[model samples]
Target: MPHNLTKQPRRRHPQRSQYGLTLVELLVGIAIGLLLIVGATSLFLSNLDASRRLLLEARLNQNLRSAAELITRDLRRASYWDQAVPKMGSVDNNPHQGITLDGTSDISYQFDAPAGAASAAGFALTDDYRIRMTIGQTTQDLTDPAVAKVISFNIIESKNKIDIGMQKIPAATPNTECLTERRYDITIEAEAPSDANVKRRLETAVRVRNDRVGNCS
Candidate 1:
């Protein structure tokens, strides 16, 4: 028999293959995670700044309303039971007036009243003294260290605004109602925080409830 070598069946060997992520892929995944975290953090911080500004706006609005209403309440009762109205005119500016609606102004509410009952039955009536207070501006700079400043006061003149009025009350004695009613106007100009260009204004017409009838002194 020809020694033809019995060909041995070729043995099949499984090929060894490389597996798992490459170094490049691992580095890419880490980079992507870092990017995501940075983006998310940026968005959150921006939202927080916006919310703070809104809250600031709301508080400013409330403060303005409070100042307006408080002043009006006192003026509404002007002239009391009597119908005598008050005189309206701007005098020299004062910072403590507390009647101005604008952040800056100095003005006073003036009216005549009986000095006392000294001349009660006499021809001359009350001896009224003029009262004046300054209206100043209160400003806070949200930037920097967040400081507040009081700007100039008593800046506007009396003729710059509309005047309010009421009918004069008839003066009487003994049985007199003792109280008079007066009406007048106070003009206010406000400035909004954002866009310093936006202006918010408020004008209050008020009267003292117990306005006196003429000079009683």
Candidate 2:
């Protein structure tokens, strides 16, 4: 037999490569990634809200306490007339004329101003401060635009001892000999302008040192 010129075709194997993701697999992976992102975002928002609330609470408490302490100190010194001095009155052009015992929403009282004192030492009944205490021993406008807001400030006065739970009894008899006793129920409400929910209320009693005392001469 005559040999065929054409050689038999050699057998060849086709190589297989990795296949790409199917449509269903790609969609499932995208869905999982979205869920993770959503969860992370929610967690971050929750933490942020909690932190803001805490900061607001702290600010409210601080403002309330500071205002309370200052008011209390002033009340204790109310009507402080040196050991022997005529009671504050219309005479001598005395600006501070004892504590106003009316059930007013605000309180106004006069305290002895040290010799050579700049202005009379006193707090206006209105939250609008027309007078302020300075570290340099000076006075300034209390109602200045920069002043903080006082939502509510009230001074309730009582004579002798009242059994009311809101009362604060004095260590000594309010009135001794020629002295008269004046008890004060102080209530204050404060909040920042930005946040109404964050607020504070404080109530306390203070006894005036020389409310209506007289010299026994």
Candidate 3:
């Protein structure tokens, strides 16, 4: 009797919960992740290239400056004949000039006296020679001055060179006299064989001190 009063429960189908992502949503998320990765990679590569170029430029400048210093120092002291009397020597069949450049890149000049002891002023020429600069290897000699350290030496002689005259000097100037000196427009260049980009050149004007007064009249 009790069971007959209770109503019977009806069976019903269970509803499926929609919780998973759609195929399109999954594909979009993957595409966005790929873009982020690609952007990061591109930025990294760009920075790397810039850093490499800066390093290369620095190397080139350093090499160039070092080479220039070496050349200028010697050139300024070119043809420095000490206080001793000048005695000309025969250089390659040419007159014993203070500075000698024989068409080629080879240059020889006298800084000290030809045959005499060292001078007290420390500016005297000794043993009839000073130094010579050339394109080839450094010449090692006790009788001669040291060779120049450079890759190439090119001399450009300007016809309208400025001649430092007596009027240019002060009234009491002692050794600052030059009648008509030789003016040399020189270009010194050097390069690293390993890297073609690492090359440098420098141009400077050098006046021969011994050639200043032009045979002292």
Candidate 4:
């Protein structure tokens, strides 16, 4: 039995199959990756453009509102008189009651100063399409021309009157008294200088606080 073990044949194990991607499969995977990257980049760029457009629109709106507010505030102070209480019966007593509009682009008015002096002020649209404010000898630009372009500035004036019949006069004579109220409607349209498509329009009404009273002669 020991002599027979000298020539025994050895058993061999089978080789395992190696797994790997083929050339075609590798190229398909690379193409798919590139497509995904391109899609993501496109989406990001779209979102960025939308954000920039929104910001421009917001800025245009803000500029329009600010210009409107300034005009309304200053116009409200028109016809203010420190001695209005004593001169209520006279139509030509208040010197600061001259509010005039030239065509549709220029508006001017007068107001009583803190020291009881009359001050002249006006707002005008320049040839370059910008809003300019003139108060006394000083001139300034209300809106930044680089940021926005003013398209139009329009003003409409309206008046209302109330009649108080048979009022006792200071001299013991009966008189017919009438009260006149004045108001103005302002419209401002503007657009972003960088982007003409971004635009805004604002409309507001301002009523004069100081009423004018006179005998309905």
**lDDT of all predictions, in order shown?**
0.38, 0.57, 0.48, 0.83
Off by over 4 Å in 1: 1-16, 77-104, 110-217
Error of 3 at 18 (Å): 4.7
Evaluated at residue 131, the lDDT of candidate 4 is: 90
TM value for model 3: 0.52
User: Each model's number of backbone clashes?
Assistant: 31, 3, 6, 0
Poorest lDDT segment (10 consecutive residues) of candidate 1: 117-126
TM-scores of the models, in the order given: 0.42, 0.62, 0.52, 0.80
lDDT of 1 by residue, 1-217 (tens): 4556766668988876866888999999999999999999999999997786666555544544555565566344322221132332222221212222333232233322244111101000011211122222322221111111111112222322212332223323322222234454644333334433333344666554443433222
lDDT of 2 by residue, 1-217 (tens): 4457566777887866756888999999999999999999999999998787778667666665666677678767665555335533222322443665445554656665576342234444454522233323454433222323566767677866323222112324343223457887877666655566666677878877664533222
- Candidate 2 is scored at a TM of 0.62
Rank by lDDT, highest first: 4, 2, 3, 1
Off by over 4 Å in 4: 1-23, 90-92, 164-177, 214-217
- Name the better of 1 and 4 by TM-score: 4
RMSD of 2: 8.9
**Can you list the residue pairs that collide in candidate 4?**
none
The better candidate by lDDT, 1 or 4, is: 4
* Candidate 4 structure, TM-score to reference: 0.80
Candidate 4 structure quality by residue, lDDT tens digits, 1-217: 6877887787888876857888999999999999999999999999998898799888878877888889889888987888888855544456676688899889898888898678899899998989999988999888888777999989898888889664634656566777779998988898888888888888999998877666666
Positional deviation of 97 in candidate 4, in angstroms? 1.6
Error (Å) of candidate 4 at residue 27 is: 3.6
lDDT of 1: 0.38
